[model samples]
Target chain A: MRYVLIGAGPAGVVAAETLRKADPGGDILLLGDEPEPPYSRMALPYFLVGTIDEAGTYLRKSETHYDDLGITFRHARAVRIDPAGKTVALEGGESVAYDRLMIATGSRTQRPPIPGIDLPGVHPCWTLADSREIVRRAAPDSRVVLMGAGFIGCIVLESLIKRGVKPTVVEMADRMVPRMMNAAAGGLIKKWCATKGIEVLTSTKVTAIEDTGEARDPLRVLLDRGAPLRAALVVVATGVRPNIAFLEGSGIETDFGIRVDSHLKSSVDDVYAAGDVAQGPDFMGGWSVHAIQPTAVEHGRIAALNMADGNASYQGSLAMNVLDTAGLVSSSFGQWQGVESGESVERMDEARFRYTRLEFDGERLVGAICLGRTDQIGMLRGLIQSRVRLGDWKARLMEDPQRISEAYVASTHK
Target chain B: MLKSLHIDPGKCTLCMQCEMACSYENEGLFNPAKSRIKVFDFHDRFVPYTCTQCAEAWCMSACPVDAISVDHATGAKVVSDDLCVGCKVCTIACPFGTVNYNHDTGKVIKCDLCGGQPACAEACPTGAIAYVDSDWTGYDKMRRWAGKTDSGAAQAHA
Candidate 1:
């Protein structure tokens, strides 16, 4: 059997490895668009901070990992996939026939249609190439204007601080990580950044970026409100959308992303989807795109299992985001925003920048948000994923949200 | 034969010998805070917890850099300190909360079962922790039950 996986991101690389393990005799081909080795985009921030080199960003450290597994990894981009013909048309006029195909083409950075966004100093902190440019331009004590204080924006902020750059974060949303974090949590993050001397402008938009016609400080960032900020570089962290333009008219059902079933199978036969591009089942109930790495990894494994003829079903992707903004760690899991008619409990110590909020759907914990706490945080995911009835522990947790470890042990052990 | 750590929390007396041993063996320090294995006090009881070395390890799979790998000799999912970029993705990915980030070193750390001879099992004063057969961790209990139900019919047949 010939197996073909497009996009050599985490999901694609994992799917390729899993397929090799599951079907040792099957012919596997992995296609990546970039010229570099299959690397983790998540590691780009670390790379920008000079914590790790480019080699450290690679998914597998060994150069011949894929070759040793007998998986042919080629640097090629899939322009179109003919589901009916079971063939994938490449960019350079080549078609590869496949018995099983995996659409793991991950999301691309969403470039907002702001004027002068294509300026030399203005760049999105998405790929390794972007990080290289950012590293060269973002000098110590240099003023850097950061756009979009979302999850990626917060991460880039941390990297910028590590590089000793004066960062001014501008978010169009009311708070930082508005999509993932609640108002209180987001406000706390902004306060924490302020304490660290990082300027975070919430509920603000970048109207335009103008070239200053200077070599050192080359960009002028015009905001919707307040005075225009001059900076050496401007980083865009707007967001990302699924790379599903090629899947258009391919008979694959798409709503925001290519819709997949519980088995990660696409609308077409002998084809599957995983990672950011697949709008798979959400842990809460309906279908939603979970663009997190954990979800992508889980989706890849499950999809590979199903592709190998092994009966496996995905339990849906949980929305989980963990961010470190200039030394303050924050995490939100599942439905952080409380569901309709659901009871919620919160404990905030703004002085210490410690906070915990738990959302409950009846007796079970449906969601949680934690800040400045890392001890046994995974228990939150465990408790939420297990869907174990908290019983009396629910009341106990409502009284003290910090008793999560105790509650998890009590509920799960029983 | 492949061996695994069989932990009997019921036999534990909360001596914290396992923690010290684990920290000393891995980190070259006798600090329980730096220990990979932790003994959590639950007000009434203390339970020693560490990596169970899952068959389908989530920490290994969720690692973006493939830093976590299974030790061929021990079957323990070990994190390469050099390769781990300290992303902490494994810390959140682990459902059991075994993998933890070491702030001092800026890398994630987890139980590696002490290569093959587990320090926690060796240091346990009471036999609460034991490195036994991976497949037959309950063989001793099963043997005890067999001894309890021993009848002369088996001897007669033999």
Candidate 2:
């Protein structure tokens, strides 16, 4: 069988490799739009921090990984996919036919319409090219105005701090990481950043950005309130949306992303979707796109198994995020925000910047948020994923949540 | 035949020799905190745990850099320290919490089964740990049950 996969990111790469393993003699072709080898976008932050080189961002270290596996890799952008004809049209007016197709075209940065956003010094921290531009301009002691305080923003904030730049973070939300953390948790993060000498402006918006006509610091950031700040560079970390524009009018279904069932099959037969572009089943009983690396990896494997006719059913993607802002680590799992009428318990130590919050639906741990603690953190995912009944341990945990490891072993081992 | 470490908590004395052996073999130190194999004390019972070397390793899959790979000879998921950027994504991806980050080295570490001869099993004084057949980890318990059944059959004949 001839298999064609698009977007050589993590999802595409994993699917290609898995297809090779499952169907040893199948013809597999992987298409990547970028010129460089298959590299991870998640590793771009490390590249920006000068921790790893361009080659280090590669998903496979070996130079002949695809070649050795007998899988063809090409640098081609897919413009359109015709499911009925079993052909994918390329931008250069070329069409490739395939028996099975995978749409792993991941998300792209959502660039908001702000004045002067298309300037030279303003860039989004998304791809490897963006990191190269950021490294070239973001010098030490230079002023940088970071836009948005979501998960991506917080990560870029850490990288900027490591580069010794004087960064002023501007967020439209009331607190940092509004989508990932609750008010209490996000406030603590804001407080922690303040202690580290970062000037964070929450509940504020950047109205416009203008060129200063100066060489040293050229960008003038005008916010809704306060004085205009002079910045050498402005990094946008707003958010991302799936790259499903090409699927329009392709007779493929889409809702925020291409809708796929447990088998990861798209509306059309012989076509499947994975990664950030596929809005599959969520662990909380609905369909939503989980734009995280772990989910992407899981989705790729499951989709490939089904594509190889292995008959694997995905058990939904769990929503999990682990972020290390500067040196403090914070993580949230599943339904971190408590459900309606669900019991919730939280403990906060502001002085130490340690916090723990647990949300429960009946006896099961529906969700949890943890900060300043890394020991046995995976147990939270295990408990929520296993859906193990806590029984008497629920009351014990409400009293002292620190005994989570003990609770996990006792409840799950039996 | 491929072998794996079989840990019996009943025979454990909590001597902590396994931890020291693991650290020395892997890190060239005698510190328990640096040991890949950890013994957890539940106040009543002490249990030793390490990487199970799952057939479908999640840490290997979740790694963005492809730094984690299987050691073909030993079937252990080994992390190449040179390639690791200290991302710590694998630590959270592992559901068992076996993969841990070393602050001193800025790289994550896990059990590599000490090449093929596991140091934890060798240093175990009470036979609580043993390197046994990977395919038949339940052979010992099954043999004991067979002996009990054989004795009952002889008694019935008498």
Candidate 3:
């Protein structure tokens, strides 16, 4: 059987490798939108920081790795797919047939509707192409105006700040990283950026970017309620939406993304979805598109297994985010926002900027977050993932949550 | 069957407890500079990394003196100091940078995982570093996600 996989990102790469392992004789074709080799989007920031060259961004080092695996790699944008015909239509009007298909198209940055947003000075920090442009323009002392202080924005903030470019971040949200962190954690991040000489403007809006002067003059980024900020470059990192627009008319189910079942198979037979583009059921009961690398890799593996090995099932995905904003480390895990009537315990050292908040539904920890104090992160995940009953130790945890090791031991033994 | 040290970077807090425990146990000191299991502080992420005891074992392959060998029971690539030439060939060959030269000992060293009971895992306050079955480190995560697909809220939502 020939397996055709789209989007050569983390999920696609893993899926291709997995198919080779499961069925060596089967033909595999991996398609990517870009001209470069199958590189990792996660390593783009490292490339931006000059820690490693563009070669370091590749998911696999050896040039012949794919050739050795007997996996065919093609650089083509899949414009449409025909589930009925069991084929994928590429941009050049070429089509390929397959017995099994995997959609791992991943995601693209959502461009905000604003005037002058498409000017030469503006860019989004997403693909390797964007990184290349950013590296060219965002030199030292190159006044950069970053839009969106969410997870992606904060990450870009670090790379921009490292290049000695004092960036003025503008976010509509009341705090930085509103989705990944709580108000307190967000406040801590803003303060940390301030200490590091980066200006963070929460509850702020960028009205328009106007270029009236000569080529050398910086663009004037007009704000709603403040003076226009002069910026050499404007980075749009507002948010990301899955690349499922092409899946229309394909008869594949899609809600937030391409919906897949317990086995990572889509509603359409012989077709599967994984990565950011695939919206699979959540371990917490609904469905979500967890675009994180680890989750996507797992999705690819499981999808390939079921497509080939036949009895593999997908449980669900856990929502997890780990961030290192500048120097202050922060992390959040499943249901961290807390459920109704869930008992919670927190320890805050305002002076040290250290905090821990644990959410418990009866004896089970539903979610937790940590800022500065990063202890028992894995144990917390273990407890929540396994839904281990804390038993009487729940009361002890309520008294003091620092004894998570003790809690892990006690709960696991029971 | 050998056991494995599972590393979940998402759970690391940059506490450096793993480094301290590793140094104390292996080097008889509390210096982080001497620890074998290095925690990469990427600023935005703190990922504690060490030798993965690769199935293809590059360090062992590059060992000119046949000093590097795999422990059959644990799957960890161990170095015999007496046989090592201290040429730093393994250090250069390791793709993950887990292998390092101990200038004081005139030999290269990496995490032996403390003879299967990793002190780094024990000292980790956050369960980011765990020792589990070598064959399946993702079993816990899989089981957890599976549990969520079971009764109650899952069925209700379905």
> RMSD in angstroms, all models?
6.4, 6.6, 9.7
Can you write out model 2's per-residue Cα lDDT over A352-410, one digit (the tens) per residue?
99999999999989899988877667667767877778999899889987777777766
lDDT of 3 by residue, A357-379 (tens): 88998889988777774333445
In angstroms, give how far residue A380 of model 1 lies from its true place. Answer: 1.0
Report, for all candidates in order, the number of backbone clashes. 0, 0, 5
Q: Mind giving the per-residue lDDT tens digits that candidate 1 earns over B12-74?
A: 889999999999999999999888888867767777777778654778888888889999998
Candidate 2 stretches greater than 4 Å from native: B138-158
> How far out, in Å, is residue A379 in model 2?
2.0
For model 1, the docking class works out as acceptable
Per-residue error for A355 in candidate 2, Å, reads 1.6
Q: Rank the candidates by lDDT, best first.
A: 1, 2, 3
* Quality class of the docking in candidate 3, CAPRI style: incorrect
TM-scores, all models, native as reference: 0.94, 0.94, 0.78
Residue pairs in clash, model 1: none
Candidate 1 on A56-86: residue-level lDDT in tens? 9999999989989999999999999998899
Q: What C-alpha lDDT, on a 0 to 100 scale, does residue A119 get in candidate 3? A: 93
- Per-residue lDDT tens digits for candidate 2, residues B48-145, read 77777765577898899999999988888999998898777777676666788776787889999988999999999998888888885633442332
